[model samples]
Target chain A: GAGVSQSPSNKVTEKGKDVELRCDPISGHTALYWYRQSLGQGLEFLIYFQGNSAPDKSGLPSDRFSAERTGGSVSTLTIQRTQQEDSAVYLCASSWGRPGSPLHFGNGTRLTVT
Target chain B: GESVGLHLPTLSVQEGDNSIINCAYSNSASDYFIWYKQESGKGPQFIIDIRSNMDKRQGQRVTVLLNKTVKHLSLQIAATQPGDSAVYFCAENSGSNYKLTFGKGTLLTVNP
Candidate 1:
């Protein structure tokens, strides 16, 4: 794709249900990132992947949050036993995996946990 | 933990006027800074960026100024337009970190 692509532009689920959000990064981009934006709040970093290196999961809010990147390309974020507080916009971004590379973002998936 | 923060929560500017948004970062090691504009229901769009080595950088109608001494960053929009009404965020990244730490953001409203 010419730009980063995210699946299921919007998702709504009952509390305690699990949800999986997918992201397709731009071709040739070796760095991928996931962030959460609460209503009217700043972006909170969730995870980052650089090539085949170990992903930085330090920013994950809890054990219920986890992400994986396959082939250094597409990525998926899974939220287990979702809570109402999980309601927010999930944003995916990709970069060149080099210093000073600007990130290209996807439209994002708005997850509403009722 | 180190973080980026905005000095103002919101600003209202008249159309055709100049708009400035400010940010402060806590980390002195941060080497790269970026500004992003996000509209309602949309992802953040890259505005411009500046490196710690340079004091300023300019884009189409936007300019980014970095003051490493005070760890402050600002974005200036020339001739603000109604379409420029959006939330602006400042992000910082260091050489050792791959993730960009974002600021709370400043809502800029261009009033006609």
Candidate 2:
């Protein structure tokens, strides 16, 4: 793809339901990241993957939130038993895994839990 | 627990005037900084970036200034236009970690 691509631009799920968001990073980019932006809030780091190294999951908010990058390209974020507080925009970005590389962000998936 | 913060939550400037947005970070280890502009219903777009080795960087009509002494970063927009009205965020990276810590953001409104 020309840029980071995300699926389901918007989602509305009931509380306690599970939701899955997907991201397809640019070709050849080995670094991918996930972030969450609450209404009127800053971007919160969730996780990151660099090449084949172990993913840095230190930023994941809770046990209910998890993500995985397959084949070093596409990634998916899964939220189990979602809560109303989880309503926010989930953003995905990718980089070349090189020094001074800038992150290219996707439009994001706006999730609304009712 | 290092964090990035902004001095002002909102800034209103007249069109054609210069606008300045400020950000402060707690981590001295951070070596790279970037400014992003986000419009309503859209994702943040990179504006400009500066490395710790330099105090300033310029791009198009925007300039980013880094003051390592005070752990402060600022973005200045020349001749602010209506299209420039958006929320600005500053992100800092520690080079080694490759993770970016973003500030809350400052809403810049350009009044015509």
Candidate 3:
């Protein structure tokens, strides 16, 4: 795809279950980011990955959340023991690793914990 | 302790009128700023950006202004149309910071 792609447009799971969301960045984008957006709120940065550098987890809200990028191409975000508060849209974005380059984002995956 | 905030939560403008959205950042070190437009059920779309070095940057039908002294940022949309209605967000990044801090957002409603 010409832009970033995310899988499982919507997902529903039990409160104690685990779920994984996928993101496929643009062909040559070297920077990837994960963000969470709750209803009527702005985006909250979750994690970032650039090249082979270690992913920045500074924004992850809790230990139950984790993410990884394989070969620096595709990335996955996993949420363990999903709580009702975990319900939100998970957005993925990619950029060219420039200081001020714009990020292209995917539609996002809407997660609902029952 | 860094945060970005919007001056207004919602704004309604008539078609053909110019619209302005404002943001304030608490991080004095922030050097880069961006404006994004998000439609319902879609991710944010980049609109325009301005760096601290320059006070203003312009794009198609849109302009971004930065005020470092007051830590204020504003996005202007010229000749607003109904299609321009969306939630607008302002984001900031400091030197060597890859992650962006976003403002709560302002919903713009362009009425015909």
Q: Worst 10-residue stretch by lDDT in candidate 3 chain B?
A: B92-101
- Please give, as one word, the docking class of candidate 2: medium
Candidate 1 error regions (>4 Å):
none
lDDT (Cα) of model 2: 0.92
For model 3, the interface Cα RMSD in angstroms equals 1.0
Cα lDDT tens digits for candidate 2, A1-114: 388899889999999999999999989999999999999999999999886454589989899998888788899999999999999999999888865677888899999999
Interface RMSD of each: 0.7, 1.0, 1.0
Model 2: colliding residue pairs: none
lDDT of each: 0.93, 0.92, 0.92
lDDT of 2 at A15: 98
Q: Against the true structure, candidate 3 has what lDDT?
A: 0.92
**In candidate 1, residue B73 scores what lDDT?**
95
Per-residue lDDT of model 3, residues B74-111, tens digit only: 99999999999999999988877877889999999999
TM-scores for candidates 1 onward, in order: 0.97, 0.96, 0.96
If both were scored by lDDT, which would come out higher, candidate 1 or candidate 2? 1
**How does residue B49 of candidate 1 score in lDDT?**
85
**DockQ leaderboard ranking:** 1, 3, 2
